[model samples]
Target: MTDMVEAPSGSGWKLLAPVRRAEGWLASVPAALPLLALRLALAVPFYKSGLTKWDGFLQLSGGAQFLFGQEFKLHVFGAQYPYPFPTAAAYGAGTAEIVLPVLLVLGLGTRFAALALLIMTAVIQITVPEGWANFHLPWAAMALTLAVYGGGALSLDRLIGLGREKM
Candidate 1:
């Protein structure tokens, strides 16, 4: 057989040489960009929600109080109990919403942060099934991306070379 081979035509393997080149070029893109995008996309919602969780930026109780008392039906504890005490769950969720997003943005503990947000996303879905299509589902999808793919090359985890791990 000859050492040279000809590219086949009409089967789409020959005509798309430029497209193939573009694909090859795309392969060099750093993982950091997508990971950073995931972080930002995931961060804004939680930050806004966290901001809403408090009536005031300075006070920690206002918004969470209203949510636990009226809006959210966390049902974490037995609903039958004299005190449903959604407050505890609310506190956990709120704290996580605020803290996790920041951590994610900084890529500080990307996998761990993604994990916490993933759990919170689950809780949010279970707590408010009505908002599934509106918010929870989309949030969960992004959180899942972060969880499975991890912080990517742009994250602090990557910067610090955390756990000597690869994303």
Candidate 2:
């Protein structure tokens, strides 16, 4: 048997290879910028909201219990939740929001943080349908984008070259 190997004959493939690479690179640029902006914008509110919960953990927890409690008559989607349980959920939600935002900002554990925030956003949307119209879509979109694209160029994960390994 004779071994056969084919060599490039300087066809159109070679000519278009660079162009394809350039196009691919360009496509990534748009995605990267918006992702960075979204992360930064979302980070501030998320961090602040989380901090507020941490600052008033007791009151917030109580408030959750009160809001979700059966006695409150506040059914999210025709379902009544136990007061104290809602409170616990609120506390957990707040803590996740606060912690994940920081991690997102730092570009550390980006995928994990993004996923956590995504879940938090979903829970909030469900628990408070009224607020869903205003904040749910945007927050959910941002979290999803971050989950997909990860922390941008300015992230600690990228700076340290650890993004790929962790992600």
Candidate 3:
């Protein structure tokens, strides 16, 4: 008589096959959730800073010039406006930050909002050479991530079926 070997069925390892499959399905959550959380968390600081600047636009202009004018002199590649460019830049940045952060939080026009925020961040990065070392790279990274990923699953963009529409 030939000896026969039987394969294990419903063994502990076999039982874990379904669990392993479930884990594989859930792995994407780790990557996506953190990006979504970071975007949401950043919205608060951006919105608050924008509001503060809007509340004191004049002061912000003066502050912007005082803080950024010298740096602007180095990297700015355009004809200097007669009045201070830093002030104008500051106001433009403030307005974009205010409006875009709200849109970003709502996930409406997410790509557009991310682009606006990216512009504002680029302006700040260029205008404040000293601060650039600290925040410029990180801000650029975050803005680019948002621009690419776009508000993720929890955003109104997804809820409203905007994600289904072609950009």
Candidate 4:
């Protein structure tokens, strides 16, 4: 038998060859890389915000307190309302900003952490409705993406088989 194989007898194959190669190349890319990038992208803003909220370990900054208390307001149906227990809200948001971002970057409890961030994003949108177009919208989208797709193969969740979705 001849080792040579005949090519498909159509010019359509010529046109499709490059497209098929590009598809194959894309398919070869690791899912983990993009997931890691997403995690990092989501983490940076939160981590920076968290850093500003603390003067030292476990100590919330005065500026953070002031913002949550005096500056930030929840806008609801054309009415503005003060945060209930503003100091507590500051502390809670501060802690979450730090902890959740760390968790997201590490890909540990990624979905839970992402969900928590998503909730925080909603609260932030209410607090600063004008930011929706710029900050809140992108953050909400990223958080929701991570919450759904989860940390990929590079994550601790994947290594430990903690929250893997079945194929």
Over the stretch 1-167, how does candidate 2's per-residue lDDT look in tens digits?
A: 11175535678656866786787777667544666787787788788776655446445644444544543333365885544565666667677767788888788877678888888777666566677767888888888878877886767877887565322
Alpha-carbon local distance difference test for all models: 0.75, 0.69, 0.65, 0.88
Model 3 TM-score is 0.62
Error of 2 at 123 (Å): 0.7
Candidate 4, 1-167: lDDT as tens digits: 12166668699767977887888788788878878898999899988988999999988899999998899999999999999999999899999999999999999999999999999999989998889998988888989888988888888898888757432
- Tens-place lDDT digits, model 3, residues 1-167: 11175436767767867776777777646444655665666577678777666446445644445544444543466433232675776677677767788887777777677777777777665555566666767766777777777776667877887654322
lDDT of 1 by residue, 1-167 (tens): 12166766676875677776888778767777877898899999998888776655545676687767677665555452222676776666678778899999988887888888878888776677678898888788888888777787777887887723344
Off by over 4 Å in 3: 1-26, 30-32, 56-74, 77-87, 164-167
Error of 3 at 98 (Å): 1.2
Residue 62, model 4, lDDT: 94
Best by TM-score: 4
TM-scores, each model vs. reference: 0.77, 0.65, 0.62, 0.85
Off by over 4 Å in 4: 1-20
1 against 2, candidate with superior lDDT: 1
Q: Model 1: runs farther than 4 Å from truth?
A: 1-7, 11-15, 56-58, 74-83, 163-167
